[model samples]
Target: MHYVCLTTSDPFLSLRQVRIYREKATGQVYAIKKLKKLEMLLRGQVEHVKAERNLLAMVDNNCIDKLYCLFKDEEYLYLITEYLPGGDMMTLLIRKDTLTEDEASFYIGETVLAIKSIHKHNYIHRYIDVILII
Candidate 1:
């Protein structure tokens, strides 16, 4: 149930950054999100965090990130998810800047499937679109 930060580097996103962590006993690497409970409460974002955690727990989709486990200490709530070695799609596309037509098609297809999967589960993604990617 214990993990150590594997590195100081983080995979940054628009909203948050994900850090790599390794389980002390198992040596399994995972993406760990640490949220400060007091900060969340002060910002009135506690419900949003709870909702996101619940959604991650309930939804089972290939395109969706898998939540492995979650635990809390006095100051922080730690969420562990599967580690994506190559990083997130946004980072990949951003690094590339532009994609070929075929590559765009492939990514668009994947995005559509991901969105559809969420829709099938009765979840709505209001702000996601292939055209809006990157």
Candidate 2:
């Protein structure tokens, strides 16, 4: 795997953000969730991140963020994943209230398919919240 040191002011991620450079020269982007100090303080969150990584690694779904790589340093853990251009679903819904039936159906169907795929792999999405947008 190729690695490079990132500078401080990349707009792609906020402070303490971990990132994965695109494999090609097209200037694409992917998100790398970093282990936060607060999360380390909470045992549950730490365990959850581990479980999420383990589960994410086992499944393959377009709706789900793809876990491409993992890295660790003295202070933080990084999980590289595919970037979902359309942010979270709840955020979108909050911005626009009351979607048409067709739109709602489409999203719901997609969510169901994702859930089904996860289940087929013997994993459960315990936190099925609206915040998860493909």
Candidate 3:
């Protein structure tokens, strides 16, 4: 908490997100996701969570969202990543309803590159719905 200052937070995402922040020292913006440990445990997603964290730490590609750090207290796990003001592709798609061919190509090409990057690391991305625009 002392390392960063919390900025805007979405109440809608509060269930699984601590939301946006601005680093105290660098003034860099980041999105910090907070996952409830108890919910993860009850849903048997602990292994998946660990695997995700491990994969993020190992992977390094421009197309991939860099996981800067992760830490946990007794209740929650936090994932800090670069903030994209453009938000996720899923949300954008819903908001736009339709996109020009050029726009589609750009996003799709980026998404493909990101998935390919993950494949290069020997791990398939099971969730492709939340591709962030960066």
Candidate 4:
């Protein structure tokens, strides 16, 4: 695999930024989430990071985000997943001031199921209180 491009404007943001890469043989694209080890340790998020990875791997639902692979170097941990082009749900909510009753119900249903799946695995997503949609 080779890193083809970075999607974020600021690479210094570490975990907040993502990079796009292509598989050398298959030509398939993947999104890479890079987390700085030092930062995670300093922020006391080591267990949270590990639980995120483990719980993602356990999940096998369509609504939840997929975790394809995981690896780490001496300084950083990398999570690989399918590349989703559409922007996150927060952006959609901001773009459209309001949703129809049916539209709102659909999103609410999906979010509930996604949360249920996470809780089923005995893991509580630290950031689940705020729905990010995507």
Best by lDDT: 3
Give each model's clash number: 0, 0, 0, 0
User: TM-score of model 3 relative to the true fold?
Assistant: 0.82
lDDT of 1: 0.70
Q: CA lDDT of each candidate? A: 0.70, 0.66, 0.73, 0.72
Error of 1 at 117 (Å): 1.9
Candidate 4, run of 10 with poorest lDDT: 8-17
**Tens digit of lDDT per residue, candidate 3, span 1-134?**
44565565543433476578787777788878789999888878888778778777887766556788988899999999766566677668889999899988988888878787778888875655345654
| Deviation of model 4 at 94, angstroms | 1.8
Task: Give the clashing residue pairs of candidate 3, or none.
Answer: none
Across 1-134, the per-residue lDDT of candidate 2 in tens digits comes to: 44443322233323246454554455557676777646565645666666778877887777777787888887788888776656557666877777899888988888888888778877776665322454
Decide which is better by lDDT, 2 or 4: 4
Please give, for residues 1-134, the per-residue lDDT of candidate 1 as tens digits: 78798764443322334688888999988877877777787877777777677767876766666688898899888888776565556767788999899888888787888788767767775444232333
Per-residue lDDT tens digits for candidate 4, residues 4-121, read: 6646533334554567777777778877778888899888888988887887689866665578998899989988866655555565677987889987888888778888898899
Reference-based TM-score of each model: 0.76, 0.73, 0.82, 0.80
Q: Give the higher-TM-score candidate: 2 or 3.
A: 3
Better by TM-score, candidate 4 or 3: 3
Clashing pairs in 1: none
Worst 10 residues of 1 by lDDT: 125-134
Candidate number achieving the greatest TM-score relative to the actual structure: 3
